[model samples]
Target: MNLGARHPGTEAAWATGEYIRHELERAGCRVWTQEFSYRGVRLRNVVGVLGEGKGPISLLGAHYDTRRLADRDVSYPTRPVPGANDGDSGVAVLLELARALDQERLANEVWLAFFDAEDQGGIDGWPWSVGASYMAANLPA
Candidate 1:
């Protein structure tokens, strides 16, 4: 889940998207990948939808990207962090929640989105919620 690496770009982002898609599908949800581009770099936003019909759709989202290797740490600024808590942990929680919702047969449509490029461009450039920003911008108006 290291979306921040040397020239990771779309490959790493897509890999994480695939993982989320697989998990959501396993939970009996219809999964879709929303693809977009930022700075000519292809990025993906994974959306898993469960249930159907009208009313407001509830969304749970988390970014699955890590900082570039250059901004990793002070000692090893060029190395990528494990991002267990930063990346995978949130996704894991969401996945579990999706599963639980499925088991309980929730009524409302639940959409789980994993945004890409959220952690890219570093703290100075992209900021913490770039993926959220992307999601907000592209969500149904």
Candidate 2:
């Protein structure tokens, strides 16, 4: 997947989304991509469904986009973070959970969502959760 920064509307961001989708699909979940726009930037959200039922849906979510600025590091303040834990850890958990759900039996429906452009706030021209808000407003099935 994208090892560099996954800023909004960037190629890296798109790659990141695809990686999540691939992993989810490999884990036996049916996946779909939701596309939306924010501040003239096109963003995508990946949704994966595990098992089938008509009850309350359980949602697992994580932001896959890396922050544009490494404001925490004084030496590399403007550089991008690898996001190994900040972004990858959450995604990794969901992916592994998806795999587990494949073997285990659950009553309710489970949804694995990878939200993009979430860590873009306070820098560049983007805001926090712009992509996520769009996804929430749309709230697809």
Candidate 3:
């Protein structure tokens, strides 16, 4: 997933979310897509749930979207970075954790959340962490 792009808020985000959902479901967990809004744009948070007990949910999150573009580098500021490390690295790690957790047993409910629009606001604009802010606002208090 290319998290850094002109429109990381586009189909790339959706595709990544879908892929995560597929993997989670394949691992035998129930998955749900949490939809939210960001600067008038619709965003998604893909959630995978494991275990049955309900109390305080343990939530793990990673942003799957990239910046609007690489405005950091002077040579190719307009280009998109692969975001293998920025985008998928944490998600990959969490996926592995989910797999392991599914294989064994857990005492609490685990929610793996892949948030969208996190990379939307880069250095100059609305600022990064959009997805996280949205999630925080929507999460149970």
Candidate 4:
């Protein structure tokens, strides 16, 4: 999946979410996405569940949205960040762990949360952690 910039509210970011959903499904997760919108821009938080234990939940999370603007880049502050490490790397680690962790030996339910709209802070008055906040507020009991 060649998700170019993965800025929130962009095609690349939506494509990246779909890619994550596919990866999670391949990793044996029951996957779904929490849909929401920020300032008229649609976003989603991809969630994957492993193990059916009714005990405490062990949640692993990572934000998948890169910054909309590379403010720290002196030469190209208006451009979006590549986020190979900032956003993509965490998703990579989570996918690997989702595939590697043995569900049969689990003590509690595990949740893999791929959050969106997180990295876009200060650009066009956007806020950080928007997807995470939405998920946390509406997580199923």
Candidate 5:
């Protein structure tokens, strides 16, 4: 559970992405990663599909990236945040739901969307929810 600070464009974030992919596979979902670039830096969003039917589509999303700097912290504005609740908590919930959900009995297709590059907003000309925006723009037809 001690994954350290998983900020975008960091090794910890990449490792965390790999862990999420493995967990999604183990939870009986077909998983994949969607790669995108921001400010010349490559990032990705992890997605897992729980069903293949043509019914409706349901998406469960959470960001996995933490801020590189704790700009909100008065004393440690330059330091990184541990992000236990900022981003990790949502990841935890999504992973648990992936494990608990029954894919076979689902009436609609469920997509577990773990996004990246979402927390470093307004810093260095970055915007919020970059990963989510990319995914939304590139959704399957």
Candidate 6:
């Protein structure tokens, strides 16, 4: 609840990324971030990993980007969602899972993917999942 609306390319978003990274590390997960730029906006994807099994990976994902404009709000269509509950709730769940599962002696690797630029759709001049698209296009070997 303390984290504010994490709009893409905003201070809140970056701070949230830092928070997720720190939390992942605190949970004993190997953590890293992927930085990408799309249409002049730079965004990040935070990833946390556990386990050493070298087979297929299991992924848990959540979008962390909040819509910059609450177009559906009757009173303040232009204002951002106060808490971005839809986005942040998933983050909270993943964080809790990361904390809970970090101690398990598992056989399969688990990855927690926090994606950005997911709530940008329908906003003028913005597209959805730009950060995720960039990550998928530039996946690591």
lDDT of 2 by residue, 1-141 (tens): 545877778888888888888888888888988898777878898989887573688888998888879977889998887788988899899999988875346778888889988887878666788766877788854
Per residue, candidate 6 scores C-alpha lDDT tens digits across 10-50 of: 88888889999999889888987899776777789999888
* lDDT winner between candidates 4 and 5: 5
Q: List candidate 4 stretches off by more than 4 Å.
A: none
Please, what is the TM-score per model? Answer: 0.80, 0.89, 0.82, 0.95, 0.95, 0.90
What are the per-model numbers of colliding residue pairs? Answer: 0, 0, 3, 0, 0, 0
lDDT per residue (tens digit) for residues 90-126 in model 1:
8899888878775346667778888777766654455
Give the CA lDDT, 0 to 100, for residue 88 in model 6.
83
| Best model number under lDDT | 5
| Model 3 whole-model lDDT (C-alpha atoms) | 0.74
Alpha carbon lDDT of residue 110, candidate 5? 90
What shift in Å separates residue 35 of candidate 1 from its native position after superposition?
0.4
- Candidate 4, residue 120: the lDDT equals 83
Give the C-alpha miss distance for residue 92 in model 2, angstroms. Answer: 0.7
**Winner of 1 and 2 under TM-score:** 2
Clashes of 1: 0
Model 6 TM-score, all chains together: 0.90
Can you tell me which runs of candidate 2 are displaced by over 4 Å?
Answer: none
lDDT score at residue 84, model 2, on the 0-100 scale: 89
lDDT of 3 at 2: 42
User: Which model is ahead, 1 or 5, in terms of lDDT?
Assistant: 5
Task: Return the lDDT, model 6, position 104.
Answer: 60
